[model samples]
Target: MTQNERIFLPWWKRVVIVIATVIVFALQIMLFVFAFQVNFDFPFNVWIYWIIEGGSFVLVYHIIHRPILTNYKLTWSILILIFPLPFSLLYYLNQRSLALPKYKQKKIDTILGNYYNPNQIDCTLELDRKDPKAAKLARILRSSTGYPLWKNTKYTFLFDGLLKHEDMLVELKKATRYIFIECFIISDGKLLSELLPILKEKGDAGVEIKIIYDDLGSKATLKKKTILEIAQIKNCTFTNYNPLGLNINPAFNYRDHRKMVIIDGKTAYCGGDNLADEYIHQKKRFGFWRDNCGKYEGEAVQSFIALFIEMWYISTKMVLKLENYLCDYVLERETSYILPFGDGPSNGAEPGYDIFRSLISSADQTLYISTPYLIIDEAMIESIVLAAKSGVDVRILMPGIPDKKVAWYLGRFHYKDILLAGGKIYEYTPGFNHAKNIIVDGRYAFIGTINMDYRSLFLHYECGALILLDNEIYKMKDDFLKACDDSKPITYEDWKKRPWWQKLISYLLYLFAPLF
Candidate 1:
């Protein structure tokens, strides 16, 4: 029924596909049957049990050796005990492939280091003169990840996805040379209908365009033909970040979750909104669709440009010179400091999580957050509780109507302790809230794609903007306060009063949340 092209498979291709499917199913069944043999009392069963145990031990050794979070290692080790063969195979598959290919890493480091002009000296002096705490954080970020403190960057905080789309269009229209877009999801609907026209107009006018979308994230909404059509546009190239295919590889879990738009390497946008109708409430599925994004201009755009280039090279195997794309025009001076940072398989240091941890550690008056998921690691739990117990007002705004129910219930298991430690948890009464936001003391703000969860912080590629002394910081704080006013707050007593069955299920879900 759709106007798009459809593929009619040939007999040979169909036969190959059928053969692959049958083989995969057969392998899975064999694994299950062999696993079942551990319960039998034959000599062959003894050999099977020992073989699986030996494989699990080998996997446990590697898991212990991996420089991952202690909680993650512990979870995998426990799973290895319960289902030795499958869990061990999972560990063996995941641990080895978590790091990017050597050639890809080399390419990223070369582009990230050589082409980036962080403007560090001037930023360090500015930090020392104005905010000492921010200066310490800048040092931590710089050492951990080379993202430098940017000066004179103007920030526009868009609390709604529609508003962000408005600004994005304005910026997209102004692009004379290049436009780079990377996102987790893209669907054909109101937002894409509006966006494709602009991108087409630009591409026809000789502007270069590049795009990368996560394959698994946009599986249903984006068809392969749509990408092919876009690739045919002049100077336009596009690729799926990680192609989801028939192979049963654990590496698919490490997705590109970052949503970044860079126009001419001068203006950039990063936030929670993806290219979907729900983000803008065009045709809402869950009630009122709440989201947020930040538009940045000036020196901070360089970091975003660098991020796009890194991804573009990885996906397309084509690297462009950063100097050619630098914003040639000077930006208006502003008083705020901005640092655009990214986290991914490219580095061992989790820059996104570390930034949030620093923000929590630095909170003086208030620590506010909004995220769809509340899956936090042990270190983050300690940070939140410690911050609240130290007398800071820690308030978190999570979604009421969840996209995933099991994880939503599991999130409640974490609420009891934080509520006791002077933390407040509120659920949006209207619908889903997909904003990844954090504000510290109404003076500093962080808004971007870094969700406060295990999958986002540890596994997926992510990006965020660190705002200091920006007037928009107050706006960020106000948005959270307004959400709180409209939401239902959960008390410690209420958290403790959850039914025993719910508690048991939540705890059960929580045990395996690290992998989620």
Candidate 2:
């Protein structure tokens, strides 16, 4: 729904926030200068100073109390110990900006809660009869994560953005009730230029259309005038998520890194490909930009709609009823199960990371993964190593052509360790592989927008679909096998001689990974 009034900070609150932020940062600089640059001799025993010494104690207490990643905790501890007041000021600001108010998060959850309520499937007996091990994995998914395994949901695995581009248009032309598009990035490029006309025509046909894009994600490509014009379209609504401003807020780190398209609540698409030229290879950036997109047709699309409604509420504060957009279309039971789920910085559960860990730990025969970036933490490393060491055929495919050099090196940082543990690593020799997919024992297929990096796991909103016992699982496995032919294998011997300087750089970058 479109509205004239926005749920936003009043002008006075905005002024206060800006002024306070400026004063805090200025004081931080002054403290840094005073502590290191200008040493004064007016002190009688520095340890006797109550405020500084007490603040040091307070920093220690904060470090102990803050529920942050261990690596980040250690890194922050080093900074706070070295520069107490400045780092403490930064810490306060970071927390202030990063944490969404509890009431707002609760409101968002309350609106979308029922859709995510746990409901077990009765077909587990059947699943168990066929494959007991996969059934066990299914139980873990439903018990640990709230998403229930659903039947009669159909899935379309679009291997690349080019393929997704062709199929998405076919589905868009059939939208009867409404259209919702949310993306991490929506740049002015070949993709949008081609899709906007279709959206405009649908809007003209009295279809309710809404577009939500990440502010930072599309900042470089989408212009304000473009958003205004889109809003002017008939029955069209638009909002930029976590819109940019001049204020120094901690929220800058938390992003909407999800990409999905929900049409009439009957079909939904989710994957790593953003609406940019490079993603579809319209305007190539790093050779061939290979990515994946998956479309769900049936009841599972409801989860994606709920996710969109949550973000729409968070951004516009508009009241939305889930049932109005939900389609009651049912499909024949072809796939064993399809559970669409989301994860974010919010409390309670992190479905994306939890499921990934569960799959890695639960695999019996083989494990395969493809991702754009591989900036994992300790827990993930342990899982991969343990799985490989246990004789599970573990293999990971990475991009040979780099998009961000630092992220590539960070992935390489784990090469020696993972290779030594019997894990096989391959780099796609053709170009960048932005596809994020994981297959285990050819029984489960996970395809979505999540990348194997710190940002996607810990700092951003992400979503994916887990396909179980589907014929597409075999297709996913076959795709991996085909990719292997075009990929270059990296063995322990190959990693052993890579420049020591590069390893050192990756380690240093990895230390501050949580910040990125």
> Which pairs in model 2 have colliding backbones?
none
TM-score of each: 0.89, 0.87
List candidate 1 segments past 4 Å from native: 1-45, 248-250
- Residue-pair clashes per prediction, in order, are 0, 0
State the local distance difference test value for candidate 2: 0.78
- Which candidate leads in lDDT? 1
**Model 1, backbone clash pairs (residues 3+ apart or across chains), number:** 0
lDDT of 2 by residue, 1-516 (tens): 011111133465446544644664466556645655344564443334436646865775576455555555555655665567787767665553254667788897688667643345556666777777667766665654455667777887777788998899999999889999999898886788889899999999999999889999999888778777788889999888888788766666678888999999889999988988898788867888888888888878887888888888877889689978887797887447787777775534456766787788877788999998888766677789999999999999999998998889888887777788999999998899899998998888789988888678766878888778888888888888788789999988888778888879887886566555
- Which prediction has the highest TM-score against the true structure? 1
lDDT of 1 by residue, 27-128 (tens): 545765676675566667756666776666577667656666655666786677557767776765555345477777887788766754546877788787
Instruction: Score candidate 1 by lDDT.
Output: 0.81
lDDT (C-alpha) at residue 380 in model 2: 74
